[model samples]
Target: MDLATLMSKGLVGPLTAPPAREASFPYGLDKHGLHEIAEAAYGDRAAATGFLLAAAPRPPRRTILLWVTQASTARDMGRVPEAALREATGGKARRLSLVTRHATDALWAVEEAVVSGVVSHVIAEVDSADFTATRRLTLASERHGVPVTLLLPHICEGATAATTRWRVGPQPSAPNRYDPRAPGHARWRVHLERCRAAPALVGQAFDLEWNDETLSLNMVPGMVTGSPAPGEAPPHPGFPNRRTG
Candidate 1:
């Protein structure tokens, strides 16, 4: 079934045939699936990169990062740079081998890796992608039982071969229970723009709070709904005002 339509109707499940593949792990990252990451804030690409790095899985086998840059630029693709990855993984990026290339070569390399069956996960940061390329990768990744994640820039729109497309935008600060004066790591309001695998989760904008300690994300339910403790204020700016006289 088409992901966009299924997600719109709230009928979410596994994308492929009924094997009940895992959609998401304990961490907020999807499993055996594809998800989109957009700017949390207007231009906070670094935050987006951090979110992905935090969520990236480091398998014992291999985690391939195909960092794609402009066709002509000699500059580095700083989205998932070595330094940032090192910080995110606590200096364990040595576990993950890296590949940097221009978009043209990167696309071909991704296809090659999908068919090789040697890597556990493939992550690509590309300038743009069409449905055909996405579909090709999707099929190959599924056949190889390897998950693929596409990291596109702000202009990531139109059709895709991904299982779910999420518009991850920044949210208001998460009140630090322990340190009232300090901001928590980060929080995101994820709009499940499309969900081919688990369509029931589509249109279900999950307010996710990431815990750096556990390296996992949990669904913060109260942010969307007005339900809160008695005499307590509703959290988040988008929630309705609880101050009924």
Candidate 2:
């Protein structure tokens, strides 16, 4: 065929390809967004809190972190220890604690903190949040470029506008390498109930260990059982205990 004829025929169009999507373990939680971590059980609030502290992205030095807690949640779960916060953030960040009388007030404080543009991060412990409340927080977080993490009770359900929702519970602690009798790294079972950033990852569960020494959250294939006796052989790694939904 003549070149002019082929050109006129429009044999081919410009090649095009869709952009590849980037994925993170906790989805966009470490980034600038509004995410929720809910307890898998009545007493799993502590586990959810620990997971938040371990998994949240560390902020810049001397930055402020506004931690807002509802009165009920504070009374039930207690406040996070200073030493734990120091280890979690490497003592580079400061925390400003706020106690709200009600969930609505707590949510309001969280959104205000995000919009104020003063704190580097925000963590709020509330009874629950509906779609409208979460939507407001998400918008504020996006507009201000600050990340907000919500710690919700096990009863949290139904619609939510958060970028991700994680159901967290305590897992068997990893065996201590040096002292078998001592507690090892803290572990948790994290289930992704909802994810806007990576919907495909929803319903997936992970076994995570928080290594204080390394200050990192790591996923493990299996968890070791209880420590061995003085002369007993070391226990082998096996599947973690599974919880029914």
The top-ranked prediction according to TM-score is 2
Off by over 4 Å in 1: 1-30, 40-42, 58-77, 81-83, 86-102, 177-179, 223-245
| Each prediction's whole-model lDDT (CA) | 0.60, 0.84
Q: TM-score of the candidate numbered 1?
A: 0.68
State the displacement of the C-alpha of residue 104, model 2, in Å, after optimal TM-score superposition: 1.1
lDDT per residue as tens, model 2, 145-199: 7889999999999999898899999987887888766768998999999988788
What is the C-alpha local distance difference test score of candidate 2? 0.84
**C-alpha lDDT (0 to 100) for residue 203 of candidate 2:** 97
All-Cα superposition RMSD per candidate: 11.0, 12.3
Off by over 4 Å in 2: 1-22, 223-245
lDDT of 1 by residue, 46-157 (tens): 5566566666665544344444344332243343457656655555335343445556566677778767866655676666778867776766666556666776666678
Q: Return the lDDT, model 2, position 87.
A: 88
